[model samples]
Target: MEVVVNRQDRRKRRLVRLFLRLLLISLVFAAACAVGLLSYTKMQGPPPLNVTQTTVYYGADQSIIGEHHQGENRHWLPISSIDTEVIEATLAVEDRKFYSHFGFDPTRIGAAVLANLKTGSKSQGASTITQQYARNLYLSHDKTWKRKWNELLYSLRLEMNYDKDQILEGYLNTVYYGHGAYGIEAAAQHYFGKTAEQLNLAEASMLAGIPKGPSYYSPLFDLERAKKRQGVVLQSMVATGYLNQIEADEAHLEELTFVQNELDQPSTIGPYFQDTVEKELIQTIGIDQALFEAGGLKIYTTLDPQMQKEAEKWVASEMPDSELQTALVAIDPRTGDVKALVGGKDYTESPYNRATEAKRQPGSSFKPFLYYAALENGYTAATTLLSEETTFTIDEGRGSWSPSNFNDNYADDFITLLQATAFSDNIYAVKTHLLLGTDKLVEVAERVGVESKLKNHPSLALGTSGVSPFEMARAYSAFANGGKRVEPRLIRKIVDSEGEVLFEAEPEMTQVLDPKLAFIMTDLMTGMFDPYLNAHTSVTGGSVSHLVSRPIAGKSGSTSSDSWMVGFTPQLVTSVWVGYDKGNLQKPAEGQIAKRIWAQFTEGALKGQLKKEFPVPAGVVGVKMNPENGLLATEDCPTHRVSYFVEGTEPTKPCPPPAADGQPETEVIDEATKEKENLINRLFRWLGN
Candidate 1:
């Protein structure tokens, strides 16, 4: 009887142990359920607010003008609002059991585990759509056990609180597709230039494949790789019953006709312009992180796309082969808006924006500033300077310094300042620089928009000073805008994602020179094309006559290695520079290529535009003068002798008398007489005429 009792006691103890084990298991299950419910409740606590969207505007002709961004920190759109095909394809490829699962699929988990075990590596993911949404929204994409557990719990909570459609909607709207694109709406517009509604099955499939690895499957990088990934997506859709085999086959066979419409269009304005606008936006409005990161902004630019296209095409086709790089900048002088810019040949080849970033010797381009300085310091077109032999020596601490003209043929002759400028005579310019003083020239250049560093020396007169194309354009604008300097700007306004105006560019104009002085300079520059003034040389006509269809003014500059042409109409200013990236001296023929480009672009851009000359304000007047003497001309003066002047500054007196000393002077006579004398001199002296 005692042995039987002991057996019964042992049986009771075993039964007790089994009961405790079952109770502990039930408690654990209950705790898990409570945790999951709490998590789900937290996730569904509040609906997200929609962020503001920004739109860009173009020019008066519908060219991109600038961009506007509005909103707070998030650029958010509901997933259900997006196209159905994109969602269908994404689910078909990313999570097949998304709809039927509660939060996670045990069968899929088991299958993934078995697959991983068989492959000896972890490659399969068993996350349902709800899980993926939870992971993207709440968890980092770090592949770790703890994070995975958290993701699983979050998925359960999301599924419990939201419907399958809601989960998917949130997921699609929040996922990252790389290239700075966030959400399907931004991705759709960025990659295909089409909205979600317009995406075709092939495009949907292509986008669906991107989330696996956007950079790897980007169509821009490798179309074949993208197509292959797309094929896999299509196959998956068929297998999972999202698509029938017939549909899948059709999709696979479909040639991807990605209409690169956005890229083909002149979508973005001048990069330098855009950069300037961005800087201002940051300074004035302060950057909205959310809009900047996720909002798809449509920026309207002040650029005329047609003109910008022509400028780019001309530069690319006409720049010399030896010149591996070149830069061009165009601005609306009246508004100080940048219209077009070419920073370099290819962005991928080099991202160093030469237009605004490079500071190089400006060569003869610097002469314009010197001339302007001379005008400001009481020098006039009629001012006489001895262009005869002259020299200057400076102590360089160790040795004496001297400079000479390119030809070293300095005749001791008096020439009008206007004549010297029209010819771009180096010796004359240097002598004038010495007389005017380097400090005064620096002051004029700075006021006129030369932002780069200037070296105080005689070479400054010859454009030995360094400056950028952007600065040159701005400086030239003073002439175009009648001596008013308008600071160059790219962006007109900045809006947040919510369409709040955070910043706007207020156009600023400052008078850099007296109106009369500017007119005098323009008139003098215009005479550069005068056949009489530029006789015996093959210099291109003045900027005005070169664009004879309209009025314009400009200067050409060539350093030992760099060639530049900066010009402007009343409405626009453009500067072009051509040279080796390494600063090697280019041949003259190479330099001409840049000029041809400028001519071609200007010709095409100005086509069909009204022919308008730079308006000479009421105080300015036309005058007649001898090309050789720059003195008042009688009624018998040639038609080529016409010039412009401030009303009070016009030449009113005859030229001064020649010196008493018997000095040999270059005689100015009629062309017929000059030709006869030249022939006789050539025969007698046996020297080339």
Candidate 2:
């Protein structure tokens, strides 16, 4: 019995020694891990914020045209500026033990882990206010393990650097609160038409409830959801001791007021144009997205209010909802200044900006590029091409493409390039496109500021590719402005809230087409206006001939679904498009819908301005030629028309009469003398035999 007791004592001592050794090793490992984590947190530093500013846009005349957010509508407010009740409610709902926790609550985290495990999902919330602030300030709201690790490191760093008040202030100011509003100040002004400091208990609690799920609790969008969320916030305040039972009940029943007076939305004068400017502010000029959403910027734009008014009047009067939809864009060809732009029939009924966003086939309006391509490749206005019905085969089993004229009336006779353009001859354009090469045409279109992606096919010559009205107007501006390619300018300059200049803009012009070619194009476009000049065959926009006060040049394009009339003057250029938003377009009354808009706008916008004529530049030769053979004309040439030719490309030879005439105009034979000479010749011939 004594030997067994001693053996048991020895066994117990050995077991106790083994447990102590293992415990010592675990403590050392834990101490090493804690030191490593602390070092990592030090490296993370402070959270950074690159917030967007609010921007105010002005017209060329310095009128308040638009106000838009750069990114998020936010205002950084100190804790003192924010209502105490609002802060209390946020703490209760977001982080209950926020003040006591050192960046994280291990107890809550453990609880969250167990709950998530039970539910078989990672959905139980465990992020403290500091963690949320870290994510909101520096990291994107992604749920990846990498992002989570970064958030943990950033939260620890934030806690180490900033006090509880500073972290809370940062979190409150940076939280997104729907409808472009961010932070407590922006939310207060957006929801209650009051400042953050002036927010009452009811308004503050409601505002605090919104940050949980902004869209779900947006009072303007969902009042019931917002009220329900507001009740939850009041209950949280009661439990957190910020409000007693009586105060919480009264706060819930209190009537909350929202934005009552005129909210500073974009004005009615140019809603579409303003929206477009806001979008392009970031897209084209490459402004930082944060700057755009941050608000508080002053922008000067290229809008002429008088012209905009005239544009709006014409669209509203001409095109009602009963008729087809329309888009109009006017620009200064020389400066690329967008003077007036109307995107749709009514901005109230539809806010979509059709001018800049929508793409529709310009149809024959696209031919100018093809013609420009031909001119560049050594083809003249007098160059003749057969306009008979023709078909060409396509590649890769797509079969053949047979393009038809607007009325399918093929001119079988020889058609001059200028005359064909006036008539918008489809066969003539397709033939020239094929001859000049499809790739060459696409190049000219791109060079002339047609920004939309163009199709590299033969039918592209017929304007089969979809384009916005702005693209058409900009392309036509090249011809009007002596071949200089100028993209439409919306914003002239931008200055941030701190009076720092962010961006300044001017017309960056590139001479894409030759001045001579541009002049010739302007001349060729006259056939569309002049019926008496082209034997009444090319009178396309002749109905508006009486309204045009200045020397104008342009083309008209019509497809089954889209009709376009894009014309320009030496001073100003304009494009008009008409189509149904849905369903194919039908022919408009009186004339094409585009023509009416163009004429109406021209009459109004150009009323007080001087009559501008296209300047005839150097490097061109004008000659009288037979339009039939594209050669120098004689007194009795079949057709006599003065054709301008690019120097050295003009026809050098004179027209020769047909053989039936038998003699030149310089020589003549009388009938009586001819008969006597014939008789004498016959008698002398008989005697010699």
Backbone Cα, N, C clashes tallied per candidate? 31, 17
Error of 1 at 320 (Å): 2.8
Best by TM-score: 1
lDDT of prediction 2 = 0.80
Number of clashes found in candidate 1: 31
lDDT of candidates 1 onward, in order: 0.70, 0.80
TM-score of 2: 0.60
lDDT of 2 by residue, 248-308 (tens): 8898899877874333354676788888887788788788877666666788999988889
Error of 2 at 426 (Å): 1.0
The residue ranges of model 1 lying beyond 4 angstroms of the native Cα positions read: 1-32, 35-81, 84-126, 137-147, 156-169, 174-183, 186-192, 200-256, 260-305, 392-412, 495-502, 536-549, 581-586, 654-689
TM per prediction: 0.72, 0.60
